[model samples]
Target chain A: MRHSTFFWFFLPTGLAMLLFIAFPIVSVISQSVFTPHEAVFVESENCGPFGCTTETTIDQDATAALREAKPLGQFVGLQIYLDRGHLATSEVAAAWRSTDSMGAFFKTINNLPFYRAMGFTLTYTFTVTPLLIILGFAIAVAVNSLHRHLKGLVIFFSLLPMIVTPLIGSLILFWMVDSRGVLGNFLQWMADDPDLSLKASTGLTWIMLIVYGVWHSAPFAFVVFYAGLQTLPQDTLESSRIDGATRWQQIRYVVIPHIMPLVTFVALIQIMDNFRVLEPIIGFNAEAHARSLSWIILNDLNGETQLLSSAATTSVLTILGVSILLSPVLVRTWRDFNSKA
Target chain B: MASQLNKKPLALSLFSTGFIVIWLILAAFPFIWTLWGSFKVELDFFSKADWTNALTGARTTVEYGSPFTGAGYHGAWVQEEFWRSVINTAIVCFFTVTISLTLGTLGGYALSRSGFKYVFWLLIAALIFRAMPPITLVSGYLLQFFNWNVWGILPTTIIVLVAINQPFTLWMLHSFFQKIPKELDESAIVDGCTRFQAFRYVIIPVMWPGVITTGLFSFLLAYNDFAVTTLLLAEENRTMVPAIAAFMGTTQTEGNVMFAVAAVVSATAPLFVLVMFFQRQIVSGLTAGAVKG
Candidate 1:
């Protein structure tokens, strides 16, 4: 544990993070300010015999050379961030001034790409985090009451949703909700309207995405909470039971407090996760209805032009969003560490 | 607190039983239904005439003279070259899990034993790093990977994923290492062993269980990732998840969504097997944080 040994031991991972994780963050922040080179134009003249004419010609070779030499592009600070695709400060102001009512304002603001995406992202994050925690807790409690042999079988199936690839998981659900699929038929039958479709409504799309999020993640919470349940104090439960506490009362008073730390752990992780909700949006083909900050960045990154600057801007905004979302957990962890010390 | 008590609370038991049944159906039915649907002919699975045809394989029986056909799986795995992506995923997962575990084990041990103030802050920094949307970092990597000519290949993507997977692995391994008494290695050091030798001889032998648990998670991350692998990899170099996504994209135009259905079930089978085998390790790995946090 000496300084030299510690340095040597940590060097590889520290270097990896610095080069890949930490360094890219710095690079992304700077890249947001820079852009790819634009084509240069120059007047070209041609003379034949006696007459000469000039035309504005794009200097493609020069532009390619320039881009190759300094590929980071020109530095334009805060411009991209404030543009319509991102912060959209001017657009927001216009929407705010044009619309008098809160509903109207949101209607207009929702037309702006960033705000709309942000709205879905925030709603998805906040709604899914607590919902999954409650669902996971319920599953844990229910499974804990099951017979021992059934426990492994239930847990095995439970782990499937959590372990499967996010896109695959969502796609499986996505297909099921197709009008021709089983769930889709069942849904239409239940509603007594054959034309009823999940894909038509933005509200339904968002609900499906959130449901997928919960289905995919609740197992994580269940497994963690289930494990926590194993270490519960028998004495405390016995004492509570002897006091004529109902099962619900016992869970509310005794069981919950014991697993409160796990709850915090699951909540913190889920919020961080839900904030980066990108894959489900793509998998559900819900991008038209529910774009996330991560999806916006991917949108920019994947196209033919590889909108690096725009993607970088969105990346910066997303990092800021993640930091803001995670700030509470950071502060609590720090405070707890200091107190323990 | 399983159903161990002698006194039968019939109402609670009934409610729990109902909840379990509902949850099990919710959790397990989608895959089972999809699996069944994948085997039947396309129309029989997505029946227009009667919804019961899906159950009856009506068109499937008419076309193939049987209720099932491997045509979708055949189209995907052979015609679409889905196996290339499967192999690519295997390579990426194997290398990523191994590399990240190697780096994470050393780094985690250092953090746990060093007792330096910075160790705490390093982990804190890693926590922040771990939480950041990795796609945000992909923009940074895009220009660099292009400039360095490291883009669109398996090894570069593997190393990048290992780096992204590092923080969580390190945190998990660090917590797992903390549970072992420091004296395990310190005693070996006392018996004429250097620190490195003690770690190699004493600590590592005992670290396999934790590493294997951590390794399963790393494998999962590598296997399950879409953001990093999708962006960094080339068309031919795509992993299974992105390949499946691609299948969804083109299959609609091809009028062959069944290919995607077959691919989905194909992709899910390995994960199901993994869960059945490594359920205990997965659970332990998950709770390693809960117990400490």
Candidate 2:
């Protein structure tokens, strides 16, 4: 009777999940694999900036010959044009005729800047998540030690960045970093040199971007850690202190282990969020140095004739990559649930 | 007693105060700068050395010597664009918070008490949605909506903001609901209450903190959002962050002063009120989902 009641209760949520979330992802992955390359219609009527229009008709003989050579339904190739209604070369057309294999298609995408962007994203996520976790834990511990009245003030103030828009944060950073701004000027004075400029390309751009991200995200980490701290059984902690455990020892043995689940949670989220870091990139124009996976997806999607397939492929890759990396967390979560059940 | 002696209260208090002061200063630098920058005039804003210049500093006879030389508080406050941005933000926040809370609370309750065999799947879905970068979804939503042919479509700006905020709120609220015991629902039902009635009278009251925290965070999400608003919103409907971006993007030098002022006002005002009202709940809610049994 209990089993029947439980089954009836869960039916709606299960259906909703299958329909809304799982369906979109499955469809996206299927589209990535089975999607045929159709000729993109470069609409002549409203083409912006780039005014190139050309149609190359493949003759019956050419189609037959190309199909015989590649044994594919269609040829995948770039059609370059100098102007509206003009084809650049028949050679360009021939190249398209020969390239029909999935291997070539995948190779083309992998060779593009997308892979580099993915690398940057991975690095960003790995770097930021750990740093944010450590910083957050430290801040949370510090805040937890404060008196009741001052604790509120400390937490509220630390969380200020989480409230400000990332774009605004970038703007503030931009002003400060600009050669003429106060920060730049201060650095110049501190160096005792009038000629030193802070705006020039250096590793500093990446540093600044990371700093901005840390400032914005640490509040979230701090708040979560603070909450975790609150939930630690007071008796356990008091017992640890009674055993003559030092503060560091208590934190290491008692608090860290207790909060490991929360730390893992924060780490998982930070990985995803930092991997998709786009606003600060756009706002700061740090894209040249720091192109994250999301930036690559955006750039690909924004092509004159949208490369939805490529974008979809990249999105699938990201989802898969992140899932693989987070498998340990997922396994732990699953095991915990199974044990509980 | 001997062990307790080592945990000196005064030393701990001093240590905590020192640490907090440093953290607060680091965290509050951008906000304080925004506040200060908002008050300064254009020339004083851009003049590299003029950061130290007081509001009453020598008004040079040269035109554009100082932003304060010409504009007063009234003049600054009367800008049409500034006020419009505030209204636009409020509208966005109101809709975002309302929709998120309504759907999130219902969905969260369903997840908590429904004994749904697929509750794990729902939880995973919510996490995926929450985990996917806002930018990735924003790009897809933009392309899909830009070419949308449906008549009477809501503005892309509003839709994008709502979509970006929904996943986060849903995840947070779902966790909140899950934290509430199922026995509450069973007891309420045993007392002749319907599901909706129990939810309304019992669950919601107990879960108000979760709701408030989620709602307030949604408001902050909407208010702080820029990439979507900038990319999706048309010129007339742009929110405060995008407007600040525009002001920064433009050629005008004086606009930065205005941008800084607006930035401070827009980001701080709502957040201040939220933190004041729901500090405990907000802190607890943020951490609760992070570490679960």
User: Top DockQ: which candidate number?
Assistant: 1
lDDT of 2 by residue, A1-341 (tens): 14444444444444444443455466445434433433333323444589755555536565556545643223233221111111223433443566697666444443346555765677677877888888888899988766788777787788777766677667666666666666767777888976666445536677777877887889998888888887897778888888878878988999999888888788877777787787777666677677777776666665576555456556666776777776776787788878978
What's the lDDT for residue A308 in model 2? 51
Model 1 chain B: ten consecutive residues of lowest lDDT: B1-10
Q: What is the overall TM-score of model 2 with all chains considered together?
A: 0.78
Per-residue alpha-carbon lDDT of model 1 for A214-318, expressed as tens digits?
999999999999999999998898888878888778899999999999999999999999999998998889987899999999999999888988998999998
Model 1's TM-score against the true structure: 0.97
lDDT tens digits by residue: candidate 2, B1-293: 64454365777768877877888988887667655555556544445665565233332224446434334333333553556666777787787677657766776666666554577766765666666555444434433354464211324455555555655666787778777888887799889987777778988779877788788777777787755665556667766776666655552465535544455455566676777777777776676566653
Per-candidate DockQ values are 0.77, 0.39
Span of ten consecutive residues with least summed lDDT in model 2 chain B: B54-63
Return the clash pairs for model 2, or none. Answer: A10-B116, A53-A84, A53-A85, B41-B67, B42-B67
Error of 2 at A215 (Å): 1.7
Best by lDDT: 1
Q: What DockQ does candidate 2 score?
A: 0.39
